[model samples]
Target: MVENKASAPGKGSLLQQTRLVCGLTLFTFVFFHFLNHALGNISLSAMNWGQDIRYVVSGKRLFPWIFYTAMILHSGLGLWKLAQRRTLKMPVWEATQIILALLIPYVLIKHIFVTRGAGELYGSNISYQHELTALWPNDALWQSALLIVVWSHGCIGLHYWLRIKRWYRRVQTPLLGVAITLPLLALTGWISAARRLELSGNQKLNVTAEQKSNLLEIVSQVQLGVYALIALVLLTLVTKYALGMFQQRISVTYLDQKTVKSVPGPTLLEISRMKGVPHMSICGGRARCSTCRTLILSGEASLSGPSKTEAQVLKRIGASANVRLACQIRPMTDIVVRPLMGHGKKMQAPGLSDRYRWGVEQPVVVMFIDLRGFTSLSEGKLPFDIVFILNRYVDGVVKTVNRNNGMVDKIMGDGVMALFAVESDMSSGARDALACIQAVSKELEKVNEDLAAHLAAPLRIAIGLHGGTAILGRIGLDGQSGVASGLTALGDVVNVASRLEGVAKEENVLAAVSMDLITAAGITPAQNLTERSVAIRGRSGPISVICLDETAIVLADFKPAS
Candidate 1:
């Protein structure tokens, strides 16, 4: 049996959480900055008032430290992530984000130095009036350009981050509406504010030649700092790659002895990329999605299990035992595995899709039908005849069940455990079950006549029906899904129905049904439906059941050889 267990909490999630928090912090700054820009729709003075409030929030001693720290850390981690990636080929949104992220530091460093760094480092009070005079006449084109670049990058990041959530799709339309409207408002306000400043003639040109040179020096230094950061990241990556080439390259054996060699500790996905293998990863190996799950064909005890983050992703898709995600796992030992979901296949949760549900209590009409005298009839027949007779009986039973909107859950030897109301309510389940028996009644009349020579006697069947709540789900040892998964109902309802069928065989009745089914179906029992109290096995007391006599629904009267 394959066992899929939920992994322990708080494993291998710190980096992801850190990135998310830092990203949100940076996104928040851009959002509020745009809002401050939007305040220009009222007036330039209003925009300055809003900008002052922004300053109160972010220009304070602690806030500036935090803001800059978040920016630098976020940028550094992003560069590190980019450097660590095995493949540049990815989804369009991911590629777009990476490109925009690279552009942000390059374009925004100059502005950051002037607006935030100038005030702190050089005692330049870069207030709204000072900034507006500088931006409107000096660098209005660059300011507008940076606004578009920053807003697009921020919006894409926010959308991608939130889209993974289940509720994201529910409100995606309205959320997209707000995403579009905010940036438009911001741009409109920025243009309006710049226009007002450009038109006003009373602008004080406060900065001297020395101060301007100092500002130019600061911007150049900031640009150099950005270049230095990128150079450091690239150099580190090259060094790591150079070291990795010599660092004990180990080949992990996959199915058919296909080997992908890489550093011993990187993920299987990393190795696959190193070997140019097309492994499926919808979320670009972030472990945010489980498109890269693999089933371990061997090395269960030898391989280390999944971390909590990998386990959590596996758990959501109902993955079974021996299945591990390729993204989060860093294999140390050579192991054999096969990918669960392949490239170009529409991926969902691997182990179980939405085809069936289980472990829930729901009322259902369970009908057990057993064919009697099969052994006696087939005693002198050839093996093929016996198999053919059994198949005919099963076929007839299945046809009748389907015609009545019932499902044949399982076949046990000469008996079939059929379920009713799988797609309907309890009352409809009872109605369907009744119609099934009547359908079987008519089917038996033709089957016995058709196979009369193969039989020593007529076919006899006892059907039992009971309706109540049962715990239903798919159970199986096969995790590939539905191959061995069997629909089962484990409750007193199924047990009582089985016992009732036994009573039917003993008392020579055509069918037996509990009072519960009769009342639920709103069927009035006929004169032939006699009430009886039968002591059932495993139950404390005798239960009231209605039995239909064989004479009322005898079915078979023809014989081919007679």
Candidate 2:
């Protein structure tokens, strides 16, 4: 019940930060390299111009050193990550990027050694003309394959990095344009440069027969080394899987109902896939998207602190210590977790699992309204009369809440818990909560007139309103919502609002409003308002409750008074 006291951002493990920096730098270099190829689409001569322009933009040896360093560091770290991974169960895009990155050094090593090595070993400058002559007709397929590998790898990495940003939505269209256009342009340029050099018949790299033989030997050794590296990787994966079979399996309980069994080899997200458990994951199990986050209820001991990437994700979601990304959580022991989303689905939603809807966290205004003294007043009334009066109260609360775009969360005997801002802004929720209270007050006044003979006095209600983040969902849990399920929320903020309603009688006020709701609504509290530091249960500190009189209510604009 205690809230997560947000402290300064904890310094997460440095591995992911270093990986991101390294990957970003390599991606920048790859982008420029692709752009250079794209220039060939204009002309082989244009391609030469692009090379000059590139040099001018990225000054001399300084840029080259940084580029090569980043490339080596990124590649090395990637292999390290590949080796350290507890599980290979990942999203398709993430898997694609890893596969391409690993294959890059193998597919690309021969070409680099042939071109750059010529200058170093043979003391000969390899020009664009020679490159074109060699690759045009004979090795065109190789060139295309390398291009596909590197470009796709870079694209997927950039997408994962940028798509999480707040500004990504604004630039989504422009990014899409480049994503579709660059590949086409780069391929055209590569072919054009090669074709032009072959037609001109000006491509040749002169060397002695002994030098050629040495080059052939070097190439063969490099090729064999690549084979060895790939074989090593395969050996490692098989060993891990084989050992895992003999290792211990663990059980994870989802809520209190479903239990999934796994061999501690795959992550919770991966286990969900294996067991056919429906879970919400927008970014495939990649840490880039935090949708696969789950709340740990009774198994904190079984889980460890998150990895650097998972820490970053949790920070982005404003998640507490109890929450973790299901994709990143691989428990060594039995655990209990609850999927926070996948409830209250509408028929119009997308994806294969259209049956369940996604839940969301948002600022909502919670208003609890209690019919004052209705329980005592109903004691001597006829059974039908009590039912009639309760029905009237329920009708008023429902109509007022619905008209203001709010939903009645629950109705117990003599009170109602209503929620606002499930699909709207927090400010709107605040305004609507106040409006509903006012409307219900008017409705009760009419009810008093209609039942003047049957009732001893006019009906009065006590309302308490507070606003903050609430997790909105639709589920039938603990018999809270009826047999036919309905939308609901559970949070300390809502509990505080309900508690305030219970204390309204002690304070001798009709309605109690928290300053948070007033601030969110941008409303000015009246000068005549009664201020009290009311201690509410589940709250760490006392809330400043402001009670408004009838006159103050009519004139109040939700703005604070000077």
Candidate 2 lDDT at 336 equals 85
User: What is the lDDT of every predicted structure here?
Assistant: 0.72, 0.72
Error of 2 at 157 (Å): 2.1
Q: Which RMSD does model 1 reach against the true structure?
A: 12.8
Over the full model, what C-alpha lDDT does candidate 1 score relative to the true structure?
0.72
Alpha carbon deviation, residue 130, candidate 2 (Å):
2.5
Q: Where does candidate 2 stray beyond 4 Å?
A: 1-13, 86-88, 206-213, 283-289, 306-321, 343-562
Residue range 348-432, candidate 2, lDDT tens digits = 2233121212344556788888888887888789999999888877887788889988988888887888898755667767788
lDDT, candidate 1, 272-340, per-residue tens: 666666566655577776657887776567667777788777786678988887876676666777876
Q: How far does residue 121 in candidate 1 sit from its true spot (Å)? A: 3.7
